[model samples]
Target: MEFALAALFELFESLDQCAPGSRAATLQALQACEGLAPGARIVDFGCGPGPATVALAQAGYAVTAVDRHGPFIETVRRRAAAAGVGDRVTAIVGDMRAPDFADGAFDAVWSEGAAYSVGVPAALAAWRRLLAPAGWLVLSELCWREGARSAEAAAFWQREYPDMGDVTQLEARCAAAGYAVRGGFWLPADAWAAYYGPLEAAVPAVRARHPQAEAQAALDDIGREIALWRRFGGEFGYRFVVAQRG
Candidate 1:
C-alpha cells in the first residue's frame, strides 16, 4: 500500500491538475455564488495543486488553500506568486477533514473534485461550522448520471467508490446536512479529458520509474480508470453542486 501510494503521488506530482476540472468550470461555479463581493473570505479544502485556489484568488477572493500534501501546498504558493495573487492566497498543508480553523472563519467553502475523500455528507456537515451565516459551499463530486449505466462502469465504481450516488441523492444530502440546494450542473467531458489527457500521456514515464509490483498495480489502476472513462463516460460524471448554508 505504501509503495502504491508513493507511486500515485509521484505520478500526480508533475501534473498541473490533480483532478477532473477546468478553469471555465470553476468560474461557472463561482458565478452561482451570489452576494460574495470582491475579497470575500473563501477556504479551498483539499486544494490539490491549487488550480481552483488560484482561480478564486484571481477572481478577487481572499483564499486560504489547504491540502494534506506538503509539496502540493508549496506548488500552490509558487503558483499564486507567479499569478500575482500570492498576497491573496494563504497556502497551508493541512487535512480538510479537520482544518482546525476558527468557527465562521470564511464566507465560502470551495472544493473541486476532492470532497469524496471524506464522504460528501460528512464534508457538508463538518464544513458548515467554518462558514458564516448563509455562506456558500461549492464542490464538484463524482456521481452516477440519471440513466442506464453500463455494467463495466457499475462494477468499476462499486469496487472504487461504493458510496457514490446520483445527483438527486447528493442534493438530498445537502438539504439534510443543512444547506439549501441552489443549483448544479454536470461537468463537461472536456474537463475529464483535461485531467486524463495529461495523466495518460505521462503513464509510460511513471511506469518506467516504478517497476515494483505494487507500483505497477497502481499504474494499472490509473490506466483502467482512464480506459473506463473513455469507454463508459456517459454513465457517470462529476457534478458541480452549488449550495448555500441555511
Candidate 2:
C-alpha cells in the first residue's frame, strides 16, 4: 500500500498541474459564496501544488495549504512564493484525515478534487466542525450526472471510487451535516481540458521514464481515466459544492 501511494505521488509530481479548473474557475466558485469576506482565513485541504491555494491567497484570503506529500507541499511553497503570496499562504505537510487545528480555526475550508481522499461524506461531517459559525466549505467532487451512464465510465468510477454520488445526494448530505447548501456548478469542459490535456500529452514522457510495473500501472490507470472522461464526459463532471455551516 505504501509503495503504491509513493508511486501515485511520484506520478502526481511529474505533472505541472494536478487538479482540474483554472484560477479563474476557483475565483468564480469563491465569488458565488457568501461569508467569505476579504482576508478570511482559509484552510485548503489536500492542496496539491497550491493552484487554488495561491489563487485564494491572491484574492486576499490568508490560506493554509495542506497536503501529505512532501514534494507537493514544497511545490506549493515555491508556487506561492513565485506568485508573491507566500506571506498569505502557509504550506504544511499533513494528512487530511487528521488535520491538526483547533475547533473553529478557519473561516472557510476549500478543497479541489481532493475531498475523495477522505471520502466525501466523512470529509463533510468532520470538516464542518473546524468551521466557525456561518463559515463556508467549498469542494470540487467527481459527481455522477443523473441519467448519464456508460459501462466503461461506470466501471472505472466503481473501481476507483464506489462512494461517488450525484449533486442532489451531495446537497442532501450538506443539509444533513448542518450546512445550508449555497449552490454549485459543474466545471466546464475547459476545466477538464486544462488538467487532462496537459497530463495526456505528458503520459508518453512520464511512462518512458518509469518502466517498473507499478509505475506503468499508474500511467495506464491515468490514461484509462482520461479516456473514460473523453467517452462519457457528458454523463458526469467535477461539481464544485459550496456550503455554509449553519
Q: Could you give candidate 2's per-residue lDDT for residues 170-215 as a string of tens digits? A: 8888898888988899999998999998788777776776677877
The per-model lDDT (C-alpha) reads 0.93, 0.86
Task: Score every model by TM-score.
Answer: 0.98, 0.95
lDDT of the structure predicted as candidate 1? 0.93
lDDT of 1 at 37: 85
In candidate 1, residue 76 scores what lDDT?
95
* Model 1 C-alpha lDDT per residue in residues 106-173, reported as the tens digit of each score: 99999999999998878888899999999999999999997899889999999999999999899999
Worst 10 residues of 2 by lDDT: 1-10
Model 1 poorest 10 in a row by lDDT: 2-11
